[model samples]
Target chain A: MCGALLVRNPKGGLDRPIALYSTALILLLLANIFPFLTLEIGGRQEITTLFGASQAMYNAGMGELAVVVFLTSILAPALMMTSSLYVLLAVRFRKSLPGVRVLLSWIGHLEPWVMLDVFMLGVLVAFVKLGNMATMYTGNSLYAFMGLIVVFAAASSSFDTHLLWHKLGIPGRKT
Target chain B: MRARDVGLASCHTCGLLLHLPASGHTHCPRCGTPMHMRKPNSLNNTWALLIAAIIAYLPANLYPVMTVISFGKSQSDTIMSGVIYLFAHGDWPLGLIVFIASVLVPLLKMLALLYLLITVQKKSHRRRLQRTRLYRVVELVGRWSMVDIFVVALLAALVNVGAVATIEPGAGAIAFSAVVILTMFAAMNFDPRLIWDYQGEDNG
Candidate 1:
C-alpha cells in the first residue's frame, strides 16, 4: 500500500484548478438556465433546462425522482464547484480559512455523487431513443453541459488533496 | 489487536496517523476535523439503510419508470420492459449498459453492503483483503446507478412535442432513485476497518 501511494501522485497544480473551476461554474450556470434539448413534433415545440426537467418530473408525480435528479445533478455539482473555489482561493491567498480543511474534505465526498458526465451520456441515449419520434435539436445548455463535464474533470484531476492538506499545515503525514 | 489496539488512529479527513489520545479527543489536532477509531454506529446505520433500500427495490423494479405518449396513445414502461425494448430494437449495447448500470449495480451494491455488514459484525477474518476490496468496489460503483434516473430526466425534459409525443416520469423512477441513494449511504456509513479487526490478532 505504501508503494502504491508513492506511485499515485500525478502532476497537479493550483493555478490550473482555479481556472478550470471558474469555467466549470460558468458552464454549470448556463447549463441550468438555458434549454438543453428542444423537441419539435406536429408543430409544437418544448424547451427544457436542467431544473426544468426536474420540475417536469416532479409535476408528473415523481417528486422523489425529481429531488434525486436535482440533488445529484444540480445541488451536488454546484456545492462542489463553489466549495472547491472557496478552498483553492484560500490556498492562493495563503490564508487558512476556518473551514478550509472541512470544505476540502466535503469536496472529496461530493465528487463521486455529482453525476454530470453520466447525465450527459444519458442525454445522448435519450436523444437517440427519441430521434425516430420527433425532430430534436441540441440546445445551448446541452453544449454548456458538455463543456461543464470537461472543465469539471480538469478541475478535479488538478485538485491534489495531499498538497492541500500540507498547505493547510495539517500534521502527521502518512507518506 | 486492531490499529487502535496499538494506539494509532488515522485521521479520517487528512490521512494523518496519530496516537489515540487516552482522553478520547474527538477532533484531529492536525486538521481540526472530528476523528474516529472506526466509524460510529457503522453496522446499525448500514443495516438501517440497507433495509430501506431493500424495501424500495421492490417497487423500483415493479412499477413503470416512465410513461410515453405518442400519436394519441400512451404507454408506460417498467425498467425491465425498457431494457427489453432496447434489446428488441437491436440497441443491445445501450440495453446492456442500462441493465448493468441501473439494475445490476444497485442490486449488487446492496448485496455487497449486506455481506460486508454481516462479515464485519461477525468479525470474520477470512479473505480480509478481498472483503476490503469489495467494500471499495461498492463505494466506487454506488453512484453509477443514477444513470437510469438521468435517462428518465433527460427523456422527460426532451420529447415534449405535445400531442405527437411526450415522456413523463413515473412513480417507480422515484422509488428506484431512493434505492440507489440509500444503498450509497449504506456503503458510506460502513467501516472497512472492521474487516481488518479480527485479522490483527492473528498477525500480531
Candidate 2:
C-alpha cells in the first residue's frame, strides 16, 4: 500500500481515475435505478433492487444489520466515487474548493467500507442458494453493479494520492 | 530512530510528518486531523473493542443467522450450519468462501489482533516487520467479513414469497454484524508503528 502511495504518476495524471470515476458514478446510478435480481417460484416473481436487500433486513427488524448492509455495500461506494470525483475535479480545474482536504481524508477512511466487491460475491452465493430453491434471473442492475465494481477498482487503484497531495500543496514525509 | 524520539509526529489521516507541540495535541495543518506521536491509548482502545467483538462472536455463531420458512415449515441456519448446508448440497466453492469470510477470517482476525496488542504491550522487539504485516492483514480482511451479512440480507430480501416461502434475518445476523464492525474498529484503533517503537535505548 505504501509502495503504491510512493510511486507517482505511473499511469499519467488523474485522467484515468477521472474518466474511470465518471464511468463508475454512471454505473452506480444505473445500478440503483434498475432491478438487481429477480426471483421466480411457483409462477410468482419478486424483483429486488439495490436497496431492496437493506430494506428487507430493516423490515425483519434487524435495523443494525440493515444499516451495515446499506452503508458498506451501497452508501460507501457511492460516497467514495462521488467524493473522489470531486477531489479530482477540483485538482483538474485548479479551483480551491472548500473542504477538499477533509473530503480527501474522509475518502481515505471510506476506502475499506466500500464493499461492493464483497457484496458481489455475496450476490453470487445468494444466486447459488436461490438457484436451488427457485429460478433466478439476473437483472440490468446486477450487470451495472458488476461493472461498477470493476470500474471502481480501476479508479481507486489508478488514483495517485501522493500526486494529489503534491498538487494540493501539502508537505510529504520528512525528518 | 523513531519520529517520537525527534519530537516529530505524523498525521494519521494525511501521513504528513510534522513537529509536535511541547504540550497538548494539535491538528494536522494540511488535513486538520488530530496529530499525535502515536495513536493515543491505542492499545487500550483496541483491547476494549476486541474484547467486545469476542463477546459478540458467541451469539454471532451460536444463534441462527437466518431462518428459511417454506411450505408451513421453518428451518433456521447458523453460520456454520449454512456453510454445511452449502457443502452438503454440492456448493463447495461458495461454501468455502462463506466459511473463510464468515468463520475463519473473523476468528483469525480477532486472534491476530489479540496477539499484536499483546506484543506491542510487551514491547517485544522481535519480528517487527511480521507484526506490521499482520496488522495490515487484519485491516485488509476486516471488511470482507461483512460478506455473510450481505448474503443474509440478499437472501432475506429475495426469498420472500408471502406464506409459500420466506427468509428472515435472525438475531445472529445482527450479532455477527456487530462482531465484524467491532473488529474493524479494533483494527483501526491499533497503531502499527507501536510495533517498531522499541527500536533504540533512547526511544525507550
Candidate 3:
C-alpha cells in the first residue's frame, strides 16, 4: 500500500531511518532534560519536566497510571528509536550484528505502544485546561517534543519493514 | 482462493507467505513467530475483552476522573464533566476534542466491534469490504482514547501546590484506562479475515 503511493525510488534505503532515528534520539534526550511546562499561580511556580508528568502521578499514589504514562511517552519511543538505529546501522554496514532479527521483531511490536503523539495532544489539552486557572509557560522541551513527533512519524513511514526483511535474506517457505 | 483453503498461511508478524505444515502448528521461518491460519480463538478473545471493556466503561464515566482543590475549594470532574467544563469556559475546540476522543471514540469503537463480531459470527455476507474497513478504523482509533488518560495524568502531575491549588487523580482515571486498554486488546485480537471468510460459504 505504501509503495503504491508517490514515486517509488529504487535507492530510497536506510539513510532516512538512520538520520531520523539519530535526530529523534537527540530530541528525546533534550525533551527529558529541560522542563516541559511550568504552571505559575499565586507567586509560586511548579515546574514539570517530561518525566515529571509520570513522577507526579506516582507521587499522587497513582503508580500504575504513572507507569503507563512513562512507558508510552518515554521508554517505548526511546527504545524504538534506539533499536531502529541499531538495526539500520547493522544493515547499512552489512555486519552480522547479533540479534538483528529479534530486534526487528521487537521494533515491530513496540510501534503501537509508543504514544508520544497522544501525549502531545494531552499536553495541549492540559495547557488549555490549566490556562483557565493558572499562568502557563511552555519550556524548551516542548519544542523538542514536537520535533520528535514529526521525526518519529517520518521515520516510521520511511522505514519499510518488508524491504528490511527481504534485505535480511531470511528464507521464506517455498510455496 | 483464501489462504487456509489451500493449506497456505501467512505469518501475521512478518507478512511472509508460507505453506502450513502438516502437523497443524508451526512457526514462521523468517520472523520466528508462531503461524496460525487465523488468530487462534479470535472471536472468543475479542468477546472476553470487549465485555470487560464494556463493564469498565461504566465506572470510567460515572466516577470523577480528577479533583482540583484550590484554596479549600474542591471540585471533581468526570470525563463528560471535564468536557462540559471546557465548553462552559469557552474552550470549545479543546472540549470538542476531548468529547470526540474520550467520549465518542470509545463508545463508537466498542459498538463497531460488537457489530463486527456479531456479523462475523452470524456469517453475514453484507458489506464485507465495509466490515473490513470498519475493523481497520477500530484498530487505528484505539490509541487516541489514551488522550484523556494522559490529560488527566498531566494535570495531576503538573498542578501540584501545597495550599493554593492541587489536582488529584480520581478513581475513574484507573477505570478509564482499563476501558481503553481492554478495548485495544479487543481490537487486536479480532481477525479481519473472518469478514472475508464468508465468501466461500455464500457461493458453496
Candidate 4:
C-alpha cells in the first residue's frame, strides 16, 4: 500500500497508433514465421527457416544459445504479437477488461526492449563480418527480416499504450 | 497492526516514518509521512543476482562469445570486434548501436544494480526516482542485449561455408546470456519499494 498510481481520465479512444501497430505486428509475425534466415553453406543449398536456425545453432555446438535466441527473439515476439492482437480484437468488440489499465502499463514497460531493431543491427554486423571472410549472400529471409524491423519499430512507436485501456472500455486509466 | 502504531508516520507528501524523539523534522522532503522501509528481500536477493550478474559480466565482455573457425587458422571475434568491424565497414551507426546495446548497456545495467544494492545497504537518501528509472531502463533494454547473440546464431546458420568457415558460440556466449538473464531477474527482484523506503516511510 505504499504507492498507488492514479489515472485521472480513462475514456481516451484508440486512434491511428493502435491500428498501424496492429498491422505492423501481424507483418512482424509473418516475417518471423515464414523465414528469418537462410542457410547456404558448402554449396549444399538449404533454405533454413527460424526453426532451422535453432537446428543450426545446436549443430554448431551452441545448444543453449540456440534456445535463448529462439525463446526471446523468436518465441517472445510471437507471444507479444499474439497478445496485442487479442487485446485489439477485444477492444474492437467493445468489451471491457478488468485491470486493463495495469495491463497497458505493463505492455508499455515491456515495449522498449522488444529489440528487433537490435537483431537487424546484428544482421548488418554479421554481413560485414561474413563479407570479409567469404562470399556472403543476403537471403530472402533477411529481406523479410529487414521489413520486420520496420514493422516492429512502427508497432512500438505507433502504439500509444496509454490509449489501450481506454479502448477496452476502462476510462481514466491513461496515466 | 494498530493505527496508533502506524500514526507515528510524519507527513502526507513524502512518507517518512517519524523519529521517536519527535523533536527533529521527520517529515518527508516531498510527500511526508510513513515511508515504506520494509522490503521483503531488499539486500539479500539483490546482492545475490548482482554478484551473479557481475560474475557473468566478466566473461561476457572479456572473452570471444562467438568464434568462427575457418581454413586452418582460427579467428575469434569478441562482441567489441564485431561492432568495430561493422563500424569500419561503413556501418558506424549500426556498429555503435550494437556496441551500446550489446556491450555498454548491459554492463551499465549490471553496474547500476551493484550501485543500487550498495546504496540501499548504506541507507543513502537521494535520487530515488532516477535510480528507479535507471532500473526500468535496464530491465526493459535487457532483451535488446541479445541482438549480438541472435546475430551470431543467425549467421552461424545462414552463412556456413562448411570446411571453409564454421561459426560456433564460445563459452563467453553462455556467460553473457547468464549475465543478461540474471540482470533481468535482478531488476525484477529489486523491489521498487526500496526507492521510497530510503526516502523515508514504512511500507505496510
* Per-residue lDDT of candidate 1, residues B51-118 (tens digit): 99999999999999899988889999988887787777737788788788887898888888888888
Candidate 1: chain B TM-score against the reference chain B: 0.94
The CAPRI class of candidate 2 is medium
User: Model 4 captures what fraction of native contacts?
Assistant: 0.54
- Report the C-alpha displacement of residue B175, candidate 4, in angstroms: 1.0
User: Candidate 3 lDDT, tens digit per residue, B2-51?
Assistant: 77788887777777888887765688888788888888899999999999
Residue-level lDDT tens digits of model 3 in A38-156:
89999999899999888878888989889889999999999999988988999889897888888888887898889999999899889888887899999999999999999999888
- Give the TM-score of chain A in candidate 1: 0.90
**How far off is residue A2 in model 1, in Å?**
9.9
The DockQ scores of all candidates, in the order shown, are: 0.58, 0.62, 0.61, 0.34
State the iRMSD of every prediction, in order shown.
2.4, 2.4, 2.3, 8.6
Evaluating just chain A, the predictions reach TM-scores of: 0.90, 0.92, 0.91, 0.68
What lDDT does candidate 4 reach at residue B40?
47
Q: Weakest 10 consecutive residues, lDDT, candidate 2 chain B?
A: B195-204
Question: Which candidate has the highest lDDT of all?
Answer: 2
Chain B TM-score of every predicted model: 0.94, 0.95, 0.96, 0.75
Winner by lDDT between candidate 3 and candidate 2:
2
- RMSD in order of candidates: 2.8, 2.7, 2.5, 8.1
True contacts kept of each: 0.68, 0.76, 0.68, 0.54
In candidate 3, the residue pairs with backbone N, CA or C atoms under 3 Å apart (3 or more residues apart, or in different chains) clash, namely none
Off by over 4 Å in 3: A1-11, A171-175
